[model samples]
Target: MLYYRQHFLHISNEGFIEIPRYIQTYLPHHLRVLIGQLQVSSHQLEIERGLSRGVPREERWCPICHTEVESEEHFVIGCPSYLDLRAEFQIEESLQLCMTMGDQWHLGRFLRATYERRERSLQLTHQTRVSTEQTITEFFQRVELHQRGPSIGLTLHQAAAQRARRRSRMVGYRRPQLYQEDISRINTTYNCMMEQRRTTTP
Candidate 1:
């Protein structure tokens, strides 16, 4: 209900929800997705998405500003990262007011550019993290090889292989006891059947 309200802004009891004309008619698929994401709160900004990620309000502050919550309002107008773009678009304090003044195209353009900028930042952050983790893993691997020798490394490899085999079995494996009427009876029957063979073999 909250998502619907946010997407529609507001709706009357009898009103039908409609897609915005620009998004439906003129905008390209990518731009449509971008604009539609904001309308539906699927833009991956820290405000709503952060809530699902268990990010506290304090930590959900705008990465660009390092102050104030990173809401849609803050992204469109408050953050200084797009100051030049905002100035070029002649956008003042209130983005809603500016859109009401009929600069909707400017808003879309600003958002498209800003979203691309944000994506670049996110990609760079991910790359940095991956690189750091790789470096750390390599460092530890080298340390292990130097200090623990080849035998320990071989043991680690065997352990990893055993873990993989266990995981593979877990995919379709079911305990035999689950389908059996009585586990104790089944065990006793197997033991009785093997008793003569066991004695002869011994």
Candidate 2:
């Protein structure tokens, strides 16, 4: 369990979960941190910061978008900064898409582009951070879905069918001890009748 957490749940200084090293190389360090935070929701987003600092609930609008309340979903799927990138990749901004889509190679490209566009120009916006989380979440979820191939119900049905077939074969089976006892009784009766016939004939 410790090993699993180290490899998969490892947290960075920015409070983002660490991704695999192979995929990590494809993304900039900051982008990787953003992805990690998105996956686990541990980042210092405006909403969280507000809660920590006792800032009013109404003041949580995205620092960048300034239109919608800063949230993970809005940042990833609705923020305007990523609209062009999302459109270019034909990526729909939906949780359903995140959880069910099988292909996510285009997402990598989108992330790289987004990262480059805002790398040094501005402070990372709540939308961007949330978007990064959503993208990573989608990628991981796709991988998980691929790994879990068939449904649990199908596997259970197969196992139950096997057990039923085995039980059906046993229905007509008899114990060897019962057959042995019957044979022994018939032999003893025949012996006694032979002795009686010999005694009477003599």
Candidate 3:
């Protein structure tokens, strides 16, 4: 019982792992979910004991390198197909480094590098052709416009000044004219009462 209790505690500790705040701040929802599953060993890796409803039993092998079971550890650290990506991105073997790297934004870079590599591999394997000339042209044009002057037709200083003016206007607009008038009247009455008190004292 004690042995089982200790093992359970160890598993619980591993399962309750918290991702670093910096990693969480930038990770998109989908990537965050993936990371969460990785932490808890709950990802759709073939090594998971139970069969998923729609997936066939034979489909559990690593798609990239068909020699191993598609476990989370195998996909991230041990996969031979991503060796080039691992070298290019300088990715460490530790999964925790994805969240806990201190000196560099390693997690984001690693994810982007891996994704691009995977996308290229898929495109090559499937002979998929996507033309992005228009997209690239538009992006460059926008960049040129930004470099020349404000993309939104306002410089930084101008935008700040506009925001300040809007805020001032909003402050005034939030208070009804009737409420201001009432406040002015109340102040006048209070001053008059103070004067009366002074006169009566003298």
Candidate 4:
């Protein structure tokens, strides 16, 4: 109910135009914090002085965009610094679309992109794979080339989990007894069996 209300307000009050059909299908239960964060982030640009705590009083500049980091809004939505990094692709347009999307999914996209860009800049230019015995550099090299977003990473992890489940089942592994399967359709059958048990009890 809260999600519906927030989404309703986001679309009606905010300039958000449309919710993509793909995301609408799942219809997540709640989104209060996500909506609040986006609202705050958008408003942060309106502030004059920077909001960051760590910067010295004299050198209060945006670490990413070099502009004076005046407000939470500047750090998030106003600063032009990330545009160069994002310009490697059509990240600016994507970010704009995400901001106006008025949903948590769009916020997730922004967060994922921000994390990826920061990690890419701070970490090695190329992804590093480390292991005890082997560096697995070749495997990481392939994954790095794909350059897909975090969503793809999640898909890969899900695929791996499915594969593991299949392998375990093939090896005769059994889940615990308490791991129940859906039995709603068999309710009548179960009632009949109970009746037979009562009849045969004599």
Per-prediction backbone clash count:
0, 2, 0, 5
C-alpha lDDT of residue 168 in model 2: 47
Give the TM-score of each candidate.
Answer: 0.57, 0.38, 0.39, 0.28
lDDT leader: 1
The RMSD of every model to the true structure, in order and in angstroms, is 9.5, 23.0, 18.1, 20.8
Best model number under TM-score: 1
For candidate 1, give the lDDT of residue 78.
Answer: 87
TM-score between model 1 and native? 0.57
Cα lDDT, all candidates: 0.69, 0.60, 0.58, 0.46
lDDT of 2 by residue, 134-191 (tens): 6654543434565765443334346568888874447768866658878989999999
Model 1 global lDDT (CA atoms, 0 to 1): 0.69
Instruction: Encode model 1's per-residue lDDT on 26-140: one tens digit a residue.
Output: 5556766765677667877898878999989667887666778898778888888878888887775874464344355666777788988888887888999888866654653
> Where does candidate 3 clash, by residue pair?
none
TM-score of 2: 0.38
For candidate 1, the C-alpha RMSD (Å) to the true structure equals 9.5
